[model samples]
Target: MAEASANIGVNFPPFLNSSSPTFLPSRTLKPEFPLTSKLKPNTWRTKPLNLTAFAPSSRLTSAAFTQTDDGKFQPRIEADNSRTGRVFFLDVNPLCYQGSKPSLRNFGRWVSIFFEEVSHSDPVIAVFDGEGGSEHRRLLLPSYKAHRIKFTRPPSSKRFTKGNFRTSYQVIRDALRSCNVPVVRVEGHEADDVIATLVEQVLQRGVRVVVASPDKDFKQLISEDIQLVMPLPELNRWSFYTLRHYLAQYNCDPCSDLSLRCIMGDEVDGVPGIQHVAPGFGRKTALKLLKKHGSLENLLSAAAIRTVGKPYAQDALTKYAEYLRTNYKVLALRRDVDVQFQDEWLVERDRRNDSTILSKFVENNDRNLLVQPSKQV
Candidate 1:
């Protein structure tokens, strides 16, 4: 549809031709909230990004390259005084609350610790998806995230009402501002896009980044110098994610995460998909089809080939081709999303107890707190 996989010339058996029996998906799990809006198919207007390279700085502290017990790389926090500085692109939603369902008011202390744990002495640019975050995606597919807006967040305790999550979010924001951590909320974009756009900005300066969020969508941004930190409320810890770790867990390269999501669709996002395929079946089927044909275009092309027996992938690749293409446009990330890259955004400011950075941010009237002693600060 919108994008094709690199492997398009896959060899197919001679038996494949136009007269084959097309397979059809038999069932799809009923959505919690049924789609009310009509699904319209259209090519996206936003331009796709042609990313040249993502080579972040090679400089590091002695412990920057530490590995887990399994020998996978772990992102390390660095000293501002270190040769290479580190900044955390902390997704504000995680610090928002555990679920739309209500939770405790412990968001402040927990977020402070989380910022400290991930950013160390380095600065954290907290990002929040504005209230209309999914607006553009809805333009792509009317059904995009139709299920989420209807549900009310449940408060964990009586003291914290379901409606108080926003209040909690504000409390966390003030707490962060007081801590000298600069936070951003682009009025009409999702936090993920803001994070992506900002990641490109920092990577351009050869600075390493740690995206602190549990959202799996950020996996597409992983690389040698960029890593993901997931909040683990159950264990009261955080899980680190890397490209190597993603491959080890999903059996496919991290680059294919978007493609896989396009084929199967995501219930969380309310993206429509093939019916009859069981929950988790989409991933297995998509992985198989991708492995065999290399890309979605090829997989769809191969679906057109006539086979002696019925093919199970008929509906999604053949009949549903238009749907897949439309979803890809919505699923793909836009790195060129016209966000202003402020110079101070790339500067990692310190958050010492003296409130020096906080005072600097307010006094300078710069959303991005300047960190340098001799110049800006």
Candidate 2:
């Protein structure tokens, strides 16, 4: 599951995109700005940027949800404030939740564990997939993410009723809103594009950002001010996938990984790979090929060599070189897409100092909202 939880503070307007940068944050001159920055860098040659570990050391106070007129569960702001230099670009997808039809209580727990890892001063802006997830991508490839809409196994009768599944996701969104986190969406864009836009936009203001999704597409967005955070909900641990993490894990850079993706294709997104041609055209072989020939363009240009490993489809790759070009567009994240931002969305909410009451947010908020309606008769 590649999708999951993440959002920020903002008073959203009726209109989405802004003509002028009304929400742009103030910037300060920094001495450490990378000079060799390019739109697309040769990632294989570049060294990894030094980034702060994703784990938060200080013990953060947990509080029960304080509801206002609208029934949303927000943390009762009560913790000593400390500065977190990064603003989190959180993605709100259910891929992180376990089992069939995950409940709102599980969502609340996700928020709790995730928030506890960052300082209260670090702002978060959670983005959700809009009406049709990635319409543009679908126009490119009709099968993009179409497979994710339906679960492989039937929904659990004990877990959630027929209609309750959608509601559970809604409750998660409502709970995040209750916390005053800006849960945003553009009419035609998915969270991936919105996150890509924000990651680049914030970096221009010199603020650091960390994207909280395990989607491989985000790997290309990794830079000095931006990183990726992968949550291991099962083990109750979160790992920061920086440039170093990727290099150590994949033996290649994110840009090179993108090139590899074009060759391998993603079954999750419904993109077909050239696996029919080259039996060994998986990750390792692709990386090996990428290393031998600096870029995909170079690889395709040179003579097709017999690759090592299972079912070598050397001729298959030669025949499908053109198809690889078409898949690249589908596999790559659109860094040039349009997205709107709210001013307050960029700033972190100061953690309040009034600490007294303590209760589990899920137990209190979800018992009625989730249980009474979905309980088996």
Candidate 3:
């Protein structure tokens, strides 16, 4: 295990003060064990396995739930002073879609940047989009992600044919395998769902995760234990989107983000918003409704009881209840995907082989891949 310095701190809100045992301090504390120990053999249990090898220590703590004045018991997560393990989840689909011309070499450059600048010695798991990745979503709504195929299609260039895409993907996979990074692709499941399930699984072991992708759909997954790092091609860097950034931008909790998106449809995915289905329901209206009601379900319930302030908003909800529900189903990421975490996935990187692969992809002018500070979303 890497010795955590006292200076290293996690990004958590300062105002939350709790003395509960479940409250972990928002700082990196010293770990009692080393990072090189082998984990116990897996029994293929139904429940979450005790991944002590990945945790800071053997003891596991669950977030404490407290009853608020409103009679709701909400989970309270205070930063524990204990050391927290970190992992990076790289989404390969977005990386392939980046820039005007997608080059096989860019895959190597991106992975190299992550290890050299973002992850350092931390473990990374590269997730690729499985075959028929969007099939399940499209089954729910045939229009789901219908517009993305044309946008993601490789341009008519001799260097970027459909065959070349497959070749590039295989080369990148081989390179990552040689460097000891686990490349994951589940049959008929998108990388987003796989990453989501993996994030949930890893969080149970008290490990923090950084999801590397530019997709806004990942915003709903941001929390104290998880964050999204978006790529910025113009600046040649990556930026983080944390829980703090999400709250600042939406003026609501990250949990409500899905509901907000339900009301304001994703143009890229071809999902129609309530504004299109029911006029006068734009982003501002959706935000205001979400801030007051907290979620699409609650807003719909309020509308049913005729308690929602505006008559038009209530009518819109009542009329488009099924549509909104379908939207939620389409947008909500599945966390129940059957994906197991492997101890071997946390193995150390082969720096020599990694450097060799990176050198093959690097141009002479491309140097100094420093991590830039996160910009406001």
Candidate 4:
């Protein structure tokens, strides 16, 4: 992945790594979307003739100092408006590894590593995979995420059982709290939904959002100001993307949130996208239907057009309707999560100080890492 241009105000004047801190101008003017296609606009919200959202400022606000002035401390807050951009790190499987030695340590390790670097660039927010604490799909469809059910099973040994694993979750939760990061979990909802809720909210507020996760489902969230960063083999290095980038790859416009996603049902999340409708075909059908009936609902129920010979169209309509009702139950992110933004969540690192700050993380005894910190958020 290409790193942000150093001339872009990256803080590398006194750092160890070849990489430079990305100083995103919080005041970047939102880009204008030009109309070039004849696609119907009723089914999907037309790309506003002037589509713009919150753009992250290139600088930090009230950049308080924790290190020395000579750059020995490697300024933690480099950009002018520090808190301008909201960075959210979504943990897909917060408890993916619960059986190994100090299993919960994985969460700690990920958290520390993320903050240690982000603290130097932007204000970061983290949302962990709550083990179903909030309103989840179970209320709508009990079979949702049934595959991961083994995770919730009661452990025979108190130390290894589901209850114990949750206890370990509490440990990881406490560590995040001490760091001042927001840890959220809705009893019945998944972490993805919570993260989505946050992304959607920020996007609406015009604040740029960067969701950190490798899951393909998140691709749907990519927009002008909103982007994605996927971790690569290199520590801390990530692959970034925008909606246009995705359009280039898939050959379909992503501005239409429903048309784009409805056709390409997410298999990972068990969403059987548009029954027999091929991937890009959903986009076409959605556009055509929207042009005729004005909305997915109207298209599905249009009596005169129901006889169209496309089996995929009928199936698509059925699935689309079912999805409309339950997918949000499944896909719409949740903002009402009990999680609250905290200050300590921002991890700070002195680039000029020492490699050991984050280097020590690569190899440490899980036990020494502290399962749960004393503080709570």
Best by lDDT: 3
Task: List ranges where model 4 is wrong by over 4 Å.
Answer: 1-84, 92-113, 116-121, 131-135, 149-166, 177-180, 200-206, 233-237, 255-264, 274-295, 301-329, 335-377
Which one wins by lDDT: 3 or 4? Answer: 3
- Per-residue C-alpha lDDT of model 1 across residues 126-166, encoded as one tens digit per residue: 77776676877888898786755211233356545455444
lDDT of prediction 3: 0.61
Measured against the true structure, the TM-scores of the candidates, in listed sequence, are: 0.62, 0.64, 0.73, 0.55
Candidate 3's C-alpha runs over 4 A off are 1-34, 38-83, 150-166, 361-377
| Cα misplacement distance, residue 169 of candidate 3 (Å) | 2.5
Across 1-377, the per-residue lDDT of candidate 2 in tens digits comes to 12222333311111011112122112222223332211211212223333223212121111222334653323333442222245677776654244435344555665665665532335678777665556677777787776554212234577666764445445556566556566766656677877887776766644566777657788877643466776666566555655445544665434567778788888877888878556556776776777666567667766356442233545555778787877887777666646655445555443342111112556654543442222110
Clash counts per candidate, in order, are 12, 8, 8, 39
Candidate 4 lDDT over 141-213, as tens digits, reads 4544443421232335634544434444445444444444455555444567667765655544434567766
RMSD of 1: 19.8
Q: Candidate 4 local accuracy as lDDT? A: 0.43
Each candidate's lDDT (Cα)? 0.53, 0.53, 0.61, 0.43
**Candidate with best TM-score:** 3
Better of 2 and 3 by TM-score: 3
What's the best-to-worst order under TM-score?
Answer: 3, 2, 1, 4
What lDDT score goes with residue 141 in model 4? Answer: 49
Name the TM-score of candidate 1.
Answer: 0.62
